[model samples]
Target: MARVLFVVFGGLAYLIFFATFLYLIAFVGDLPGVPRTVDHGPAGDRITAFIVDLGLIGLFGLQHTIMARQGFKRGWTAIVPKPVERSVYVLFASIALLILFAFWRPIPQPVWAVENPLAVSVIWGLFALGWLIVLSSTFLINHFELFGLKQVYQNLRGAAPSPPRFRQPFFYRLVRHPLYAGFIIAFWATPEMTLGHLLFSVGMTIYILIAIPYEERDLVGALGDDYASYRGRVGMLFPRLRRASPSTPPLEARDS
Candidate 1:
C-alpha cells in the first residue's frame, strides 16, 4: 500500500517537473551567456536567470521523482536505494526555493558565463553521448523493472529479488555505478563556465563522493560476499581495464 502510494505521488511529481522544464525552454528559448558576478542590466536579464535556475531546479526535482519511483517499485531496504538520497532531495528543495526567491527580488545575481564556444560544444556532445549510454543501459535493464517469471513470483511473495543480470553487459561492466558517472558527465557538460558554476559543481561532486561510499556500504551488506567480489573486480565510479578472471578463488567456495 505504501509502495503504491509512493509510486502514484512520484509519478505526479515527475510530470510536474517535466512540465515546468518544457514550459521554460519553450517560452524562454535558448539561454544567453551572462556575467558570473551580477546581472546589472534590464528586466530581461533577471528573467533569463530565473528561467535557467528554474530549469535546473526542475531537473533536480525530476531526478528525485524518478529515484523515489524506483525505490517504490523495487525495495527500499537498502540505504540510498535511489539515485539521490533523502538529504540530497531536501537540499535541492531548499536551494530551489532560495534561487526562486533571489530571482524574484532585485538581488545582485552573478550570472554564470560560458566562454570558448568550442569547449562548450565538446562538453555538450560528450554529455549527450553519456545520456545515450544511460538510456541504453536503462533499456537493457528492462526499464529498471524486475525480470524473469521466478522474480515476478518472488515479488508476489513480497520478496524483492536481486538486481537483474542485464546490468553487467550494459553499464555495470564499465563502472560500479554508471548512473552516477552519467550524472557527473552531464553536470560538467553544462555551458556555465563561470567560477560560481564551477564551485557549485565542485560542491556537488563532494556530495557525490560522500553519498557513493554510503551507497556502496549498503550494497555490500545487501548483496553480501558476491557484491564484495564484484567491488574488487570493478572500480567504484570509474571504468578500468580488467583481466577476465582474478587469481583469488570464489568467496562462497572458500566459505563452504
Candidate 2:
C-alpha cells in the first residue's frame, strides 16, 4: 500500500510537472490562447508591478536553490519519504511556477519589437529549439530519476537505490549544463521584448548564473574528481572553444 501510494505520487507529480512545463512555453512566448503571460497580465502601478514581479522571481529562485542544496535534501528527506523526495521537489517546483503564472503583473512597456519577418522567424526558431534541447537533455541523463519515477519503482520492487555514476552523454559533453543553456535561450529568444519580458529574462538568467556555482560545488563534493575534471574542461553554459588536451580524461558528469 505504501509502495503504491508512492508510485501514485511520483506519477502525478511527473504529470503535473510535464503540464506545467508546456504551459511555461506558452506563457513565456506570450502565445495566443493563454490567460496571462509575461507581458500581458493584470495591470497595476508600474512600481508595484515591478516590486511584485521581482518578488515572484526571487521567491522562485530561493525555493529552487535552497531546496536543491544537499543539506536541505538531507533534512527534507527526513520528513518526505526517501522514495518521494524527488517527486515532492518536482511538485513544489511546479506549484511555484503555477503561482508565478497566476499572480504575475505585467510591465507591458516595450523594450524592443522586431518587425522584420525573417528575423522574427529566426528568433522563434531558436525559441523552439531551446525548449527542445531542455526536454531532450533530461533524457540524456536519467529522466525518470531526475523527475522521481525511478525511485518509486525501486522502492516498489524493494530494491536498494542505484549507485551514482557520472555520465556526459551527448549534450553534457558540449556544455556543463545544457538544460540551463536551453532555458537561457528560450527566455531571451522572443520577437517582442517588453520590460516585463526583459525582467523575466534577466532575472532568470541571473538565477542560473548564481545557481551554477552552487550546483557545481555540490556536484564536485558528490562526484569529486570526475566532476572537477569535467568542470575544468567544459564551459558552464557555453561550448568550450578550446579543444581538450590529450591528457584530459573523457568527459564524465551528470545532473540530478
Candidate 3:
C-alpha cells in the first residue's frame, strides 16, 4: 500500500514539475517586469526551447529510474527515504510550493517591452546557445550511467568505508564527479532562472556538501589508505588538469 501511494504521489509530483517547466517556456518573456527587448527569434527557436525542456525531464526521469532499480521500495517508500524521514516531507513541500507559484503567481505582462524584433531574437538566441551546452554535458554524463560502466572506485552510502575499482580511461578519466557537474551546468543554464531557482540552487549545494562528506567517509572506511591517496589526487566536483598522482589504488585491495 505504501509503495502504491508513493508511486502515485511521485508521478503526480513529476507531472507538476513538467507542467511548470512548460509554463515557463510559454510565459517567461511575457512576465511583468521582464525586459521585452532582450531577445526574440523565429518559431524554430521556440521549438528548440521545448526540446530542451523535454530533455531535462527525461534526464531527471532517468536518474530516478536508476535509483528505483537499485532496490527502491514502492509507494511512500518510493517517495520517502527511510533514512532522514523528515527530509522527504521537506522535499515534497518544496516541490508543492514551487508548483503553486508557477501556476498561481500573477506575473504581470511586462510594461517595458522589447519593441524591436531583432533584439528579441538575440535574447532568445543567447538563451538557446547556453542551453545547448548545458544539455550536451548532461546527456554525456547520463550516457555513462545508462551503460552501467564502473570506474576505479565507488562511494559507499552513509560514509561507510569502501573502495571503488580502479579505472584507467574513459569518461572517468576527466572528472571525479561528472554527474554533479552536469547538474550544476543544467541549473545555471535553465531558462527559468529566477530568485526562487537561486534559492533552490543554494539548497542543492547544501545537500551536496552534507551528503558528500558522509559518502566520502564510507569510501574511506571501505578503501582505507588507498582511497585516502585517491582523495589527495582527484577533486570532489572539478576536473583538474594536473594532479600529483594519476592512478593510485585504494589501500584495501578488495572491493567493498
Candidate 4:
C-alpha cells in the first residue's frame, strides 16, 4: 500500500541520515579512514580551496534554512504528502552532507595544537560529551518525530498527527537551544585546531546565530505568549544563574 511504502521510505531515509551524521563526527574528529579532515587533503591553491569550501557550506546552510521555514513547508506539503515531507528534507540534507564530505578541501595548517597529554584527553572527553548531549536532547524532544519516523508511522496507521506542544525538558530548561549549544561545544573542543576545522566551526556558528532568530519567530507564532514568556526568562543559548520567578508557570503544563 502507499501508506506502507511511505513508512518504509521514511525509515530508510532516517537510517541513512543518522549514519551520515555519525560519519560526520568521525570525519570532523579525523578518527580514521577518511580521506579529508581539517588538516588532511590534497594540496592546492588556498584561495580556490577556501572559496570552494565556503560554497559547499553555504549550499548546505541554504538548503537547511529554506526547507525549515514555515512558508517553504506550507508550499512543499502542498505538493508532497505532509507525513513524508520531513523524510524528503532529511534525504536532501544527507545528500548535501555527503557532497560536502566528498569534496571538502582541507587546509592542513594548524591554528593551535595542544601538546599536553592530559589537556588533550580532557578536550577529547568534552568533544564526546558534546555529541552525547546532542543525541540525548533529540530523545528528550521526540527523536522519532524529529527524524520523521513518527509521522510516517502514524500516517500508515491512519492516525492524524498530534499538534505540536511546547516542552522544556532537562537540558532545555538550562538553555533554549541545547542542541545547538552541544554542536558549538563539539566543534570547538578539539585539542587540535586546523585552519580547515576553524573554517567549519566559524561557518556553522554563524549559521546557528543567524538561524536562531528565524526559529524563535516561528516558535512565537506557534506557541504565542507562552514562548514569549519563556524567551523573556530563559537565555537563548546559555543558562541563567538566577532561578525563574515563582509567578512563572511550570514549563511542562504550558502547551499551546
- Mind giving the per-residue lDDT tens digits that candidate 2 earns over 1-256? 9999999999999999999999999999999998998878889988999899999999899989999999999999989999999999999999999999999999999999999999999999999999999999999988999999999999999999887677788898889899999999999999989899999999999999999999989999988888899888888888989988889886423442
Candidate 4 C-alpha lDDT tens digits along 1-256: 9999999999999999998989888877877787766567677788878998899889988998999888999999999899999999999999999888888888877999999999999999999998999999899888999889999999999999978778888887778899999888998899989888899899988989999999899999888877888897798888999888888875554322
Candidate scoring better on lDDT of 2 and 3: 2
Per-model TM-score on C-alpha atoms: 0.53, 0.96, 0.38, 0.95
| Separate clash counts for every candidate | 2, 0, 30, 0
Stretches off by above 4 angstroms in model 3 are 1-169, 190-193, 245-256
Give lDDT per model, in order: 0.48, 0.92, 0.42, 0.88
Give the Cα error of residue 141 in candidate 3, in Å: 10
| Residue 130 in candidate 1, Cα distance off native in Å | 3.1
TM-score of 4: 0.95
In angstroms, the error of model 1 at 129 is 2.2
Candidates 1 and 2 compared by lDDT, better number: 2
lDDT of 3 by residue, 26-108 (tens): 33333453322112222233344445334433333333333333233334555654432222333343354344333322222
Look at candidate 4 and give me any clashing residue pairs: none
lDDT of 1 at 223: 66
What lDDT is obtained when candidate 2 is compared to the true structure?
Answer: 0.92
